[model samples]
Target: MTNSPKLAVRGLTKRFNDLEALSHIDTEIAAGEFISIVGPSGCGKTTFLRIVAGLEQASSGEIRLDGRPITKPGSDRGFVFQQDNLLPWRTILANAMIGPEIGGFGDKARVQATRQLLKLVGLEGFENYYPKQLSGGMRQRVNLARALAVDPEILLMDEPFSALDAQTREIMQTELMRIWEEGRKTVLFVTHQIDEAVYLSDRVFVFARRPGRLQEVIEINLPRPRSLAIKRTPEFVALVERIWNLIEYEVRQSVLEEMS
Candidate 1:
């Protein structure tokens, strides 16, 4: 990895009227690194992600990509929502082409690229199908393909697999790791699942409860080309336990504060 950061967040904060969501967050993400953010609900995990994606504005602080301040949505960043959010009227291939279409690259090359992306997400022959025709897992794969069709430098994913059933979610996680390993795109994923965070990330950033602040950044030293079998190993279990402990403490504190 290069010493320079592909993405930089400095003193980032967000507020909604009287409610402060995020506070004074700072981090540097190196090129090709996969980072995941985890915290209790309403800890501004999604807020921080939206700020980075330029979908939402930060009340204070700055987020830069390659040192340029991000003011609004751009093709350089791709966002995948918790919901698939695919267009019902469009076929799978056409939906994947949305980004390239919006960017004015709706030519044969982009269409070809979109097809490749669909294939990459393991949806090669399903191009003619509509969003309603596919299962939840397949739709999410389309969502991922759409994001990658833009060929963005960074991918901002907010709980992309949280909606799936347990079996499908695990399958998608393995698929994601494979795709990420092949592409090595810099990714910032937000999830409430501690095990998911530990399993997929190079580093996991944990946040405190509302008025979210960075509480800890845990580095995962586990070997990569990681298989689902690794999740059963002592080392993987230990890492998951460690992260769960941090989050469990924050959850308890948040509950206590509410009770008080």
Candidate 2:
């Protein structure tokens, strides 16, 4: 990491008229770092991400990328949403090529880049397959490849694997770590899974409920190039338990508020 963070989010807040979606979030992401944001539903994890991606304006706050303020969506940031969001008619290869093609990259280069990305995401031979033909995990892999095709400096993924079954989700998580290690793009991932956050992050940001606040930013001391086995280790379990305790109260509070 360098002296400056790759992304800086300062005093970030968001509102929708009567409801404050987020409040006073402050965080910095080092270049090539992988960080996860975990919190209860409606805590603005996605909203925070949108601001960084320049999709939504922050009511009050600043988001800077490489020391430049972010005001609108740009090719510099690649966003992978909860769903694959792939076009039903496009082939996997075609879908992955969308970004580069739209950016006016050369046809041959775009094709080459898309193929390489598909291979990197373990979807090499499936390039010709349609979205409907793929399993949930495979479609998400396509989503990732498409996001990476843009060659963004930063990748923001919002629960990209949330729709997969347990087994497939685990597999995709491993694939993601491998891809991240290979690509080395700065990543800000938002998810609700405690174990998922802990397993994949260099640091985990815990957020409180609605009108979200940054509750804690815990650095993961675990070794890198991590394997799923680490989740069973005493150290990993302890870390998960610690985060669970931190978020559990917020979860209950949100539930009570909803009920009332």
Candidate 3:
């Protein structure tokens, strides 16, 4: 909320015994910026995201939110995982209201806030429906609404749409862009999908394989308020191809090392 960048990571490294998952990762994310991290599997994209979310610790270096060191998870940052992870027993409204309820907000206020969020996410009338009752895309919408219910200053997402069908994934992407634009929340998204990364991020952080180091930061110069139409443009295809080449090489190298 201060004038400082919404998030900053410096020399962040993570290790499991001798296996380095991430190394010397550094980046600064401006307030309200949308950034995506992409790389081959095991490159530590999720590890870096988890460290920023305070779900995990780094072997070395630091992460700061508004210039303050991030030591553990807080309400200031919300996370949506690959799975919706909604409580199946709880109705959609109850699920979305959980965070506010835990925060000790009064019932009326929580209900009001949850309703608005459901509406924002296009899940208004479905509030009483259970997670099992909704389609995959609809349930993910609940997941998103719940994350937004907390009104976190930053949203850290790890492949939130990976499980959905291709068509659903595209729809969700469009919905997310609209929600992001409306809320202006700072977002750090992690995914292996190059096209999705190019379409959604203001900048894409291309990472090297294991012991993930940021290999490149490519700016997405496409016009804002974008939709699927932009993905077909020559510029979009070129950027996607550029990133794919980097990742494809790493993926092959990783496979060969494992086989050897």
Candidate 4:
């Protein structure tokens, strides 16, 4: 990690008219770090991510990348939504090239790079396939390749695996780890799955119920090059349990508040 943070969130807050979605979110993400945000439902986890992606506006405060204020979305940040959002008519290669195309830099070099990224994401042979022709997992792989096509500085993923089946989700988690290890891009992933968060994160940012606040940031002490087997280890299980306990408590508190 560098002496300076890769991304910084300061006093961030968001509101939807009468409802406040996020409250006073503050944190720093170092370069090449993988961070996960987890919290109870409606805790503004996705809202926070969208704000950082410049898809949603924050009611107050700011997000900075490399010391520059991030008031709008730019190529510096790549986002993977819960849904793959691939154009059904477009081939996988074409979909992956969407970023470069939109940026008006879709030259032969960009095409070669996109092909490389497609292979990196394990979609080399499927480049000609349409979205409907691929499996859910494969489609998501295309989504990832599309995001990486732009070579963004930071990757913002909002439950990118949440739509997949349990088995496919696990597979994608391992795939994501492999891709992340290769590039070590600064990533901010949001998920409701505690185990997923534990497995993929360098640190897990636990949030309180809505209006969400940063409750704690727990560092994962396990060694890297993590595999699915690590999820079975005592150390990994303990981390998952710890995060689960925190989120469970928040969920209970939210329920009690609603009941009251």
By lDDT, the best candidate is: 1
lDDT of 3 at 19: 93
RMSD of 2: 1.4
Task: Please provide, for model 3 over 76-154, each residue's C-alpha lDDT reduced to its tens digit, 9 standing for 90 to 100.
Answer: 8888999999998999999998777777764787789889989998998999999999999999899899888888999
TM-score of candidate 4 versus the correct structure, residues matched by position? 0.95
Residues 81-165, candidate 1, lDDT per residue (tens digit)?
9998888999999999999999999999889988999999999999999999999999999999999999999999999999999
List ranges where model 1 is wrong by over 4 Å. 253-260
Position 189, candidate 2: lDDT:
94
Those runs of model 4 whose alpha carbons end farther than 4 Å from true positions after fitting are 252-260
| Candidate 1, residue 46: how far the Cα is off, in Å | 0.6
Q: lDDT for each of the candidates?
A: 0.92, 0.90, 0.90, 0.90
Clashing pairs in 2: none
Worst 10 residues of 4 by lDDT: 246-255
Candidate 3 backbone clash number: 0
- State the TM-score for model 3: 0.95
Candidate 2 lDDT score relative to the true structure: 0.90
**Cα lDDT for residue 18, model 1?**
84
Descending-TM-score candidate ranking: 2, 1, 3, 4
Q: What is the TM-score of each candidate against the true structure?
A: 0.96, 0.96, 0.95, 0.95
Q: Tens-digit lDDT track for model 4 on 1-260?
A: 44889888999999888788889988899999999999887898889888888888889999888998888888988999999899999999999999989999899999999999999988889888899999999999999999999999989999899999999999999999999999999999999798899999899999886577899999997888887999899998889888888778778877788789
Q: Candidate 2's error at 89, in angstroms?
A: 0.7
